[model samples]
Target: GEAGRAAALEGLERKVKAAMRSTTLNRLAPDLEALVRAETIAVQAGPRPSADESVLAEIRGAVLAGRPLSFIYSRPGAEARSRSVAPCGVMFGRANYLVAADRESGRIQTFRLDRMTSVEAGDGLATPPADFDLAAFASQSFGIYQDEIEDVVLRVTPQGATEARGWRWHPTQTLEDQPDGSVVVRFRASGMRELAWHLFSWGEQVTIEAPQRLKAVMAGELAAAGRALSRAQS
Candidate 1:
């Protein structure tokens, strides 16, 4: 009985993993699609960012074949340059990125798919490090951009405490209720600039409690806004 139960659990786990990997709406059953359409509405305000489908296909093939990739990449405000990297996987978020490692230096990096051109897979075999984990690598940053990680601490005022408690700020985040009806949220992450941008909307309800870098970035953003407002008034 125990062995039979274990086998059934393993089969169910495999099916769950397979379902999680199937992302497109077209993969949903007709009834499920109708239910989703009736219950959900996405309010995208602008054109959704996308990568070249052909380039994505080329990179996906290279990753699956354990081959290296060569492409010309153009970073923002920079000239285009040639690159050779070992494809690890693709991360789809606000934008699509190729998570890869330099063939020569072995340094892992993320390249935006939209900025890539003339993508070609190499004949030589290349693969991610045996211990490389795509999800763990992506989680190191608050958003897409990666930098030095820090212990981030925030204090949400009583007015926003309930909302903050219900929010999923980060995968590693933990919230603690304060005696004064406030809440303290703590998490370790990078991408301070992006975090600063998000904190702007919280107004006075959120207070930065640690990591001087985030505080400085928030202050800089506030000063820039102040200058823009003054110019508009003048």
Candidate 2:
């Protein structure tokens, strides 16, 4: 029911070529509708970050050509400015991002693809750092932004333990079955706030067992949320 990336791209190409042949909007409208609103083959776009495919395509091309990219990056409450960055790779997670090393600082950074403007590829081949690994860089953070990685341990209540067994908490997680019918989840990760927010959804079914930092974060988030609710009620 859901179209994969390759299939979706191919379908889009077909729709574009069909539109190009028509001279007027009314003339192209019918054919375009049929291609998109198919009767038998229902096309569904799966969960992926929204952005201009044109920009993504250009970056993909630059990566293949081993060339750097230039673009005006916008920061919140600040002016937009241009930067040349070595094209390391494009990472797709909750959102899409261009991960690279700033040509100035030589330190790696991530720019949200949606915030980029006036993108252009450099003439010279991109020279990434000798020891930079995209996977390693990404894995340093529990979610997106990097922080101190710590050993996180969570003990699931007996009632929720069965369901938690089927959950993939993390790629590098270890799950241990306790004789008391509860499960202990352990993993090394950063981004305590994100983890805390997620565990809130578990609704007391999950309990923190170690890493004082995670417990502190969870308590802080709970207190903040409580204060907001109190203010709203008052």
Return the TM-score for each candidate structure: 0.80, 0.72
For candidate 1, the C-alpha RMSD (Å) to the true structure equals: 9.1
TM-score, model 1 to reference: 0.80
lDDT of 2 at 171: 71
Q: Which window of 10 residues has the lowest lDDT sum in candidate 2?
A: 41-50
Q: After superposing candidate 2, which stretches have Cα over 4 Å from the reference?
A: 1-8, 11-48, 75-81
For all candidates, the clash counts are: 0, 0
Name the lDDT of candidate 2.
0.83
Which candidate number would show the highest TM-score if scored against the true structure? 1
Could you tell me the TM-score of candidate 2?
A: 0.72
Local distance difference test, each candidate: 0.87, 0.83
lDDT of 2 by residue, 1-234 (tens): 113466788999779777674466668779879986776644444334645767877788887897889999998999998889888887886677898887767787888887899888879878678899989888766677657888999999999999899997877799999999999999988888888988998997999988999999999999999999999999
107 Cα displacement, candidate 1 (Å): 2.3
Model 1 Cα shift for residue 108 (angstroms):
2.0
